[model samples]
Target: MRVAFVSFETVHHRESETNRRLQTILELLSEQGHDVHVCCAQFWDGERSTIKRTGISYHRASAGLEAPTSFLARVPFVLAKLGPDVVHASVRPPKQALAARWGGMLARAPTILEWYGDGGITNDWWTRRAARWADWIVVPSELVETWVRELGVDEATVEVVPNPIDVDRIDGVSPGDSVDVVYARRLDADANLESLFLALAELRTRDWRAVIVGDGPEREAYEQLAGELRIDDRVTFAGACSLEERLAIYRGAHVFAQTAEHCVFPTEMLWALAAGCVGIVEYHADSSAHELVEGWDRGFRTTSEEELVDAILEAGGLARRDTDDRFASYDAGAVRDRYLTIYRTLQDSSSLV
Candidate 1:
């Protein structure tokens, strides 16, 4: 399949959940020997408007990242020129999605929107228009599916495709030094580390260690909070860790805590669960983190600090494991197959039309 992805900005310009997810999908498609291309603001240095990287071709839709209007205006022309079998677009600058839909129509291809619902235009009017225009919308969770449906998009038009993980890469890593509890996420306003910290303080009398695995603006504040709670020594703020480091930490730790106040999809929690950490997620109104562990035996959901403490204690009883086969379905290959199925369905439908 010749797949063309439309994104105004790529991960090369800035690192974001949406960009990273799109890049992963593109690479997966390329690895499978499919023709993959991305139309975005030029991120490479030179007079060249097109460049190839790791088997995927990137064509510039605009001169640079600064001009949104230019990026939006040129996306359709670029994609139509590329003439891919299918067009996949990121749902950020909502207008670009509309442009991609137009491009798909011009190119006689089907347009699918990947809606992470993390960052993008939030105006109901724009979002609703974008959702309605796409051939289909792909979201990370049912939580996002609900949001897209609320925009009056037909339920059948939206499908939940989870963020993919590298199961083989995870399986190959060796577990790091053991710790009693593990929490991984950017330490920002939504970190919600306090719940886990307070819960840990409650168990100060117990002999257990915890590791907080990430870094951000709130790192100092969270570190200070850990100190104030007097669990600083026991809780290691390991800062931002590579995937290998995080996997090792997850494999070594007995329990992984999910306390973020908001999550489109609990990515880190999924990784920890795959690494065999007993999942303990604190339920938040806006977050879909608990969705990953709702019916799973090795998972626990808590609504308060006391409950978090209790869940941590209970998870201690489960036997430690270095990896879990249950999450094998979330492997990169499985996710790529899901996308391929969608593309084939859309292509077949387009042919009949």
Candidate 2:
């Protein structure tokens, strides 16, 4: 099958969960013998408009920031250039998908819009209009499906397809003797780092340390909070690390904690669990991240400072059970097969019926 993956952003241009997912999916499609092409706003070379990698072709147009008002102006050119059999767009929804739908219509090909999150622009006029225009809609989680349905899409038009992580890309290395815990994510209030720091302070009786990774608006405030709690010495603000370094931190940590107040799909948590960390999620009303730890038998979730402290204390001292069993289901090969199932089904189905 000739597949064209259209996205507003690409991981090759930016290191993000969405990009990682696109790379994984494109790689899988290529490995499955599908002729795949990726189209997006390129930021890799700053000025280069196009490039190719592995078996997939990449076409870069204007940066999203440069043409927010006229985003679809370049779609016709990209479509004419690629001439895809089926266009699969990776998008959060409405705008990007809408652009793809318009471009696909002009190009006379089926278009599938991929949604990864919820609660953003679902009610926009373009979102509802474009959703109705697409051949099909794909979402990564049940939570996102529920939200999209609320936007008036027929249940039959929406498919629950998860964003997969490259489980094999992560290697589990010894966490060393430092008794360290790592929490990595953009430092935003919604990330709930406040709760994590307070919890860590509560567990100061232990000799454990924490390594916080990433940077955002909340970096300075979070740093101040750490000092106020007198736990600065035990904590390290490592800012952001490259993809390679983040994985190394995952393998070296005794545990991984995600304290986000709300999350559509927490791909980082998946990496942590895959890397053999005793995964822990801080709960809120809008989170379903705990679901990832369901059968892993390798982690738990908490809802408050007390619970987080207790879980950390326990996870730090508990005998490390064999984690191999926990990560078996998340193997990259198995994940690729999941995508193959969806792609094969779509490929066999009639176009734009």
Candidate 3:
């Protein structure tokens, strides 16, 4: 199948869950012998119209690009020319994804609109219209599924597909040499790193070190909070990391604690779990962390700062458990197969028409 993946930006920002998902999907699709093309708003070194990574033909069009008559720009010409069997896009703020969705219509291909951020996700007029227009809405969590349903899209058209975990790349490693708790997320209010700091403060007397990965606007504040809590000596701030560093950090850590207040789908947490870190997450009703860690002994859910501290303590000493058997359904191969089947179904439907 020939497929066009329309994204805001995948090459420039690789750490983001959206980018990660796009890369994984494209690679797996290419491996499965599908002709895949990537159309992003931004590409390598800001260069436009170049193919990169896994033989994907890359194209670009500014979301804000317009004609002088004040008419909105039609779908990207490159995408329309490709005329893919299916046009998939990641919908988010900045309205560019909606533009790409329009481009899919111009390309005359069935579109699968992707949106993963769900908690506190509000739709505007254009978003609602795009939701109605797309052939299908692919959401990563039940929370996101709810957000799309709130837009009044037909229930049948909304599919809750969890983001696939590359289990092969995340196989459990032997326990590290020393005990170190790990927290990997963009440091921001939503991440609620303060909770992790507070929890760590309680464990200051314990023999453990923490490596906080990822960077954001709240990094300074989180650092300040850590100093105030006097755990700065024990915590190392490792800013925006490469895929190799992140994988190593998760695999080497004894505990991986996530303290987000409202995470739709915690990608870092999932990776940590798959890498055999005894997982602990601050519980929230809206977080997909709850959904992933539910009924699993390797993961513990905490309600408050005290519970988080206790869970961390328990997680630190936990032995590596075989999680592959438990999370097999989320294996990248399984998810790739599911997507292939979906694409085939769409193609078959179009042929029938």
Candidate 4:
């Protein structure tokens, strides 16, 4: 299959959850021998209009990120010329998705917009129009699907596609020294580390050690809070870790905590669960993290610091496992096939029309 991805910016421009997801899908498609192309403002340095990297092709829709109108103006033509089997786009810079929709129309291909519901301008008129104009809208969770439906888009047009994880990679990594608890996410304002810290403080008398595996501007503040709670010695703040390092830690950990105040999809929690750690998600209105643990035996959903503490303690009785095969469906290959199925179904329906 030939797929064209339309985004005003990409991982090369800035690292973000949306960009990472797009990059992963593109790489997965490329690995599966599908011809993949990305249309966006040039992020690579040079006057060249196109470049090929790691088996994927990138075509410049504009001179640079400074020119949004130009990017929107040229994307359709670029995609039409590429003539992909399908056009998949990110829902940021809403105009770009609209442009991709136009491109899909020109090329007689289906267009799908992926809505991450992360930090971005999503409440504008352009977003609603893009949601309605695209042939399909893909969201990471039902929480996001509901938000998209609220935009006046038909419920049938929105699909819930969970973020993909690398189960094979998790299985290949060796477990590190064991720890009783693990919390991993960028220590930003919404990290909500305080909840987990307070829960740990409540159980200070117990014999347990926890590790916070991420780094951000708020790391020092969280560390200070840990000290204020007098649990600093027991909680290890291991700064941002690589994929393998994190997998190893998750494998060795007994429980993984998800306390972030906002999450469209709990990517790290999925990783931890696949690594065989008992999942403990603190409910948040704006977060869909709890969806991952629903109906799962090894997962626990908590609403308060007290519940978090209780869940962690309850997780201790579960047998330790090096890996869990339950999440194998979330593997990159499986998720790639899901995208392919959607594309083929759309292609057939469009043909019938």
Which window of ten consecutive residues has the lowest lDDT sum in model 4?
A: 119-128
lDDT of each: 0.91, 0.73, 0.74, 0.92
Per residue, candidate 1 scores C-alpha lDDT tens digits across 194-253 of 999999999999999999999999999988998999999999989988999999999899
Clashes of 1: 0
**Residues 121-202, candidate 3, lDDT per residue (tens digit)?**
6777867887887778777788778778998989998887777777877654443334468888877778888888888899
* CA-only RMSD, every prediction: 1.2, 3.8, 3.9, 1.1
Can you write out model 2's per-residue Cα lDDT over 202-251, one digit (the tens) per residue?
Answer: 87777888899899999999999999998999889989877667777777
Off by over 4 Å in 2: 8-20, 31-33, 39-51, 59-83, 92-96, 102-109, 172-180, 321-325, 351-353
Model 4: what TM-score? 0.98
Clash number for every model? Answer: 0, 1, 0, 0
Candidate 1 runs further than 4 Å off? none
- The 10 consecutive residues of candidate 2 with the worst lDDT sum are 171-180
Off by over 4 Å in 4: none
Order of candidate numbers by TM-score, starting with the best: 4, 1, 3, 2
